[model samples]
Target: MHVCLFDIDGTLLNTGGAGALAMERAVGELTDGSDRPLDIPYAGRTDRAIVADIFRHYELDFGDAALRNFLGRYVEHLDEMLGQSPGLVLPGVERLLAHLHQREDVILGLLTGNFIEGARLKLRHYHLDAYFDFALGGFGDTHADRDEVARVAFNTLKAHRHPEQIDLRRLWVIGDTPADVKCGRAIGAKVVAVATGVYSSDQLAEHAPDYLAEDFEAVDELLELWPAIG
Candidate 1:
């Protein structure tokens, strides 16, 4: 079987504006003064890291208590904002997912930086949750590092599938950022990068992913170019 691991934020959905707004609100609440800019980058990064950067930029203390409170408020209000203005999924994502779903050899999983609950909320908000197998996902809660998350995802898939044998090289990580490609490379997994995020095609190409494309519209072409799995 061939396993396909997908990234959430930029690859599957576009929650950039809503996410920034929520983070800005959370930071504003944490610091009474609005002078601190929440200019932290979001693409290809974990939520924990993003929050930490925000705290650092604002010179605010981020103890466990503060983090917990911020997270609670952020999640609650983020959900509301998403409900009000849900973002658009990338072109051909729905069609590609449906095509892959019908294939017995293809197993769909997520390797995202979002925490499990946050990941679910985003996917569910976009009505894309049911298409994925959550048991195979690796979330930010497991590890803040993307490479560690990739390893966790591989292990989880192996444990769940109980494959007679596992071949690490057969696994594919598909996403829209160099970080995603780097994480897959860490585990010797093939990476397919789509230029739908902050990075351009040339930028992602500099990372040397196994495959590169504009979007899922050419997924079939990508699959054709990928080496056959055992």
Candidate 2:
């Protein structure tokens, strides 16, 4: 079987502005100084890493209690923000997912930086959750490093299927950031870079991904280059 793992933010959905605003608000709620800017550099990072940065910026000690409180507020407001301002799935994503899902040899899963619950919330909000099997995902809760998350995802897939034979070489990782490409490389999965986020096609091209596309719009060409089915 062929396993296809996808990144959530900036790849499948457009939550850039909402995510930034939510982080800013979360920081403001925790910190005394309103003047302190919430520098939310979200690209190519895990939620824990971002939260850690926010805590450091506010000079707050990183502890479970503080982290939990911040996450609680962030998630509460995140759902509200998403409800008020719905995000869009990238072009051709729906069609691409449909095509891949029809194939018997393919398995769809997520390898994202979002915490598992956070990931579910985004997918559920976008109504994209049904396309994925959550049992096969790797999330920020498992590890802060993106590569490690990819490794975890692979293991999850293996456990779910319990395949009599397994071939890691047949795995694929799809995303829109340099970190995604790096994670794919780390785990030796075929990488497909989509220029739908911060990096342009030229920038992603420098990384020499096995496949690169402007967006999911070129679904036919993308699949032709690296078909999801094994």
Candidate 3:
């Protein structure tokens, strides 16, 4: 089978800042709206890393119990923020996913920085959750690094396809960030970087992904290039 791992956020869909906004609100609740200063970068970083930084910034405890509480609050606010903001699936994503979903040779899954539940929340809100096999996906909850998350996801895909040797040549990682490119290389998966997120095409090209597109509009090209996907 051709294993296809996808990133959420700026890759699958844009939450219109709902994710960041909810996170800000949740952290505010945790800190009681304390004086904000540090600007922790979010792009391509795992949720654990992000939260760890948040805790450090506000001098909050960075333990498991504390992290869990913060994430719980973050999730609750995420649901609320999703509704309050206008989120959208990127161009041609629906058609590409629909095409891949119908193919028996392809297995669709997520490899994202969002917590698995958080990933589901975003996907479910957009009605795209049903298309993915969550068991085959890796979550940010496991590690602070995206490459580590990619390794976990790689193993999950392997276990799910037990006895079937996965062809690394046929593996794929699709996302919109340089981190995605780096992580894809971690597992030796062919990377497809799209310019659907904050980064422009030129910026993404610097990462030199195997495939780069302005958006997911080139389904035909994907099929032609990745014949195993056929």
Candidate 4:
């Protein structure tokens, strides 16, 4: 079987600025100062890393208990903000996912930097969660490194589907960042990089992903990367 792992944030849908706003609000509630900047890069970074960065910036404790508290607040705010400013799903994502779902040989899963609940919330809001097999992918809580997440995904695939040896050649990681391309390479998997995120097509092409596209609008072009189904 061919396994495809997809990233959530910019690859499938844009969550407006809900994620950032949520984080800012969460930190503001937890911190003493209202003027402290909570700015941090989100692209290709895990929620765990983002939270850690926040704690580091503000010189707060990054212990498990503190993280839990902060994340709880962040999630709560995220849920609320998402309800108000739920972003747009990119071009051709829904149709492509539906088409891939019908392919017997293709196993669809998510490889995102979002916490499991956060990932679910975003996908559920957009009505796209049904396209993925939640039991067979990696989440941000696992590790800060995208490559580590890919390893976790491979392990999920092995435990759930392949009892014996699995070929890495059949694995594909699809996302819209250079980090996505790098992580895909880290696992010896082919990457299908999109230009739907902050990065342009030219920028993503510089990373030399196995497949590069402006978006998921062309189902046929994407299907070219997959093996023929029975």
Candidate closest to the true structure, highest lDDT: 3
List, residue by residue over 102-152, the lDDT tens digit for candidate 4.
Answer: 888888999889989889889998999899989989898858888898888
lDDT-superior candidate, 1 or 3: 3
lDDT of 2 by residue, 57-128 (tens): 778898778877878878877877887775799999989888888788778899999877788888898888
lDDT of 3 by residue, 123-196 (tens): 99999998998898788996998999999999988888863658888889999999999999999999999999
- Sort all candidates by lDDT, best to worst: 3, 4, 2, 1
What TM-score does candidate 1 reach? 0.90
Better of 1 and 3 by TM-score: 3
TM-scores vs. true structure, each candidate:
0.90, 0.92, 0.96, 0.95
Model 1 C-alpha RMSD to native: 2.3
Worst 10 residues of 2 by lDDT: 221-230
Candidate 1, residue 191: Cα displacement in angstroms equals 0.3
Candidate 2 error regions (>4 Å): 163-165, 225-230
Global lDDT of each candidate: 0.81, 0.83, 0.89, 0.88
Backbone clash pairs in model 3 (N, Cα, C under 3 Å; residues 3+ apart or in different chains), count: 0
The positional error of residue 47 in candidate 2, measured at the CA in angstroms, is: 0.6
